[model samples]
Target: MVSSIAQFQIKPIGAELHLFGIDISFNNSALFMIIATILVSAFLTQSVKSSYTIPNRIQSLAEMTYEFTTKIVSENVGIEGMAYFPLIFSLFMFILAGNLLGILPYAYTFTSQIIVTFAISIAIFLGITVIAIIKHGTKFFRFFLPSGTPVYMAPLLIPIEILSYLSRPISLSVRLFANMVAGHTMMKVFGGFVISLGAAGFVPLLFLVALTAFEVLVAVLQAYVFTIITCIYLSDALYLH
Candidate 1:
């Protein structure tokens, strides 16, 4: 049986290249990421290319996604957050596309890699930190200690609060990476059973169908979770809450 983890391997394609000692050669992960980006771009552009009073399926889907993201930002980050709508929207769509693309046969799920997810999460975390510092100046550090906390509790509470704050990116990235890895691994296991068991594989084949459907739901849900949490973080930075 093929190793379940083999599907996640990062095999380089074509010629390899290095820039300043860093290996920047394109690989399966990079190729699928590009595919996801192109697919998202094409879908969004085609969905909105023509206007209609009674929108078609594609337009309706695009509109619904737009409204959903708008509401998320409005409710989580308030009016000031509207300025970053484009960034939030792009993040949501890109992640959603990447997750869905990974569901296809032989496609690499870039989001499944902890490094990729962590890099994205850390960048967002740093950006939010910078925004908060710029907006509130020295007051940004005040967030490490809640306003109503007792002075006597400062010694204990400060460290806990700081640890939690610093762990945000780790938690965020791990959540996505873990879910993708677990779901894909389970699917692979069941697929092997389907092939190996032959006629008796019907049981696993049935389960595989159900698992695939669930994975699709997970793909959409994870993207929303990631985006909404990002909105909440941005809100905290904007309001120092």
Candidate 2:
């Protein structure tokens, strides 16, 4: 029987390449990331190109996603945040596509990797930090200090708030990675049981189908949650709340 944990292993898929002493080898995770990017680009492009006065299914989906992302930005960051809508929109669709793609049998789930998720989270975290610093100048430092902070608690409060702020990437990355890994690993174990148990495996098989549907919901929800967090971060940067 194949080990359920083996599914999460990262193995090279092609001849390895090294650039400036760095390993840039292609792998299943990379392939799926490329595929996700291509598919997302194609879907959005086609949806826009074929859009009509009376929208069809694809057009409607495309428009709804657009409007949904727009609302997230406008509500969170106000008009000032509209400038970042493209970034937020791309993030939502990319994550949504990655999650759904991994649900397919034998497809590599890029978002399941902690490195990928952490990279995204950190990039957003850093970008928003830069935005706050650039826009607010030295006033950005006031975030850690916060309004109404007591004078006697400066040392304790400052460190605690700074630590909490730094934990954002860790929480964001782990949440996505842990959910995808747990859900997929459970599904794989049940799948293996179906093969091993033969006729009696129908019980696990039914549960597996239900789990797949649930995972799909999780995929969309995770994307939405991530985007919402992003908008919230931007709002804090813009409003210093």
Candidate 3:
């Protein structure tokens, strides 16, 4: 019987490549990330191959995805945020692909790992902050300090706001990581039950099926939540409100 947590272990596929102290060898996590990226790229490519006045199924899906991301950015960040539509959309689709693909049997779920999600979160946070800095210059500091604040309240509120802003990536990354890990780990446990219980495992087998479907919904929803929060953060940066 395999341990439920065993599935989360990272195993290298081939030669362990350690260049300059960095373990850059290809592993299950890397393989799945590659697969997710390729899948998203291929899907979008095929989805938009034919552009017609009347929408085909593939075109419709592609168009829907485009409009969905556009709406997310437009609504949250307004017109100026449209400049980042492609960025926000790519992030959404990438995470969405990772979440969905990980649901497959025997597939590696990198998003379950905090490192992967944290890296993405950090990148997004940095990019948004950089944009704010570039666009607003010194006024970017005003983000943590609201205008018309009493001198007494400035010190108290400023530190709290700063901490909250700094914790954005941590909170954002952990939410996805925790969700994926919890859901996948539960499924693994149920799967183990089905295998070990023999004929009597039918109950758990049924549960496993339902859990798998629920994970699919979670996969999409997590992607949406992350993207929306990012949009909100971007909007705050742009508008400083």
Candidate 4:
């Protein structure tokens, strides 16, 4: 059991020196995030430097990523919001790489941690709020009052909108964190069964393999869902509908 737990747990890569009595631990998640950032930066740099009119492998990959995000933004947020392509693209790639990297053996899933997901969700929420307020000034508060809402119901509709708006971060963070943690935990449990039962555990092992593939798909899908919701939120800010 101890071995199984060890197999599933993430280990620290290094520790930061304490400053002002605040201890900061740097771990595998931090290492993987650095790796993910480097990978993204390198890929984009290489693709741009190549400048191949015919398109090579790296260029093809870069184009695909650009097209995917562009399509999503255009469809969901419209042309006016195209300026946000970089933010949406980076968010998708970062989460996608973090998720896919975590699926590797002995890798840490940062997205499974509530702290990371909450940080991301909170950032997105605040960014959209700032954009809306900057664009609309004090009038942005009018968003809480739905169009065509009866004047007498302003007392009721306002609170409902406020509650729904406040719930965004909670819902966004939980959806990603819960899915990643639950899927990885179940995979680890089944994998342990396969190891302990040895050759006789072929059935569980096969199921584990199937679950791994499914988890890979889930990781990609979750990243897409996260990015799409971001675009939707941006749309709400841009159009206020």
Considering TM-score, where higher is better, how would the candidates rank from best to worst? 1, 2, 3, 4
Lowest lDDT sum, 10 consecutive residues, model 4, at: 1-10
**Tens digits of per-residue lDDT for model 2, 1-241:** 9999788788898899999999999999999999999999988888787445788888788889999999988987889999998999999999999999999999989999999999999999999999999989999888998789789989999999899999988998888889899989999999999999999999999999999999999989998899998899889888886
Which candidate ranks first by TM-score, i.e. highest? Answer: 1
Cα lDDT listed for each candidate: 0.94, 0.91, 0.93, 0.88
- If both were scored by TM-score, which would come out higher, candidate 1 or candidate 4? 1
lDDT of 3 by residue, 103-171 (tens): 998899889999999999999899989989998999999989888889899989999999999999999
What tens-digit string does per-residue lDDT give for candidate 4 at 64-165? Answer: 988999999999999998999889999999999889988998788888888899999999999999999999888889999988999999999999999999
- Model 1 ranges with Cα > 4 A deviation: none
Give the TM-scores of the predictions, in the order they appear: 0.98, 0.96, 0.95, 0.92
lDDT of 4: 0.88
Give the residue spans of candidate 3 off by over 4 A. none
Every model: Cα RMSD to truth: 0.8, 1.1, 1.4, 1.9
Better of 1 and 3 by lDDT: 1
| Clash count, one per candidate | 0, 0, 0, 0
How good is model 3 by TM-score? 0.95
Error of 4 at 32 (Å): 0.8
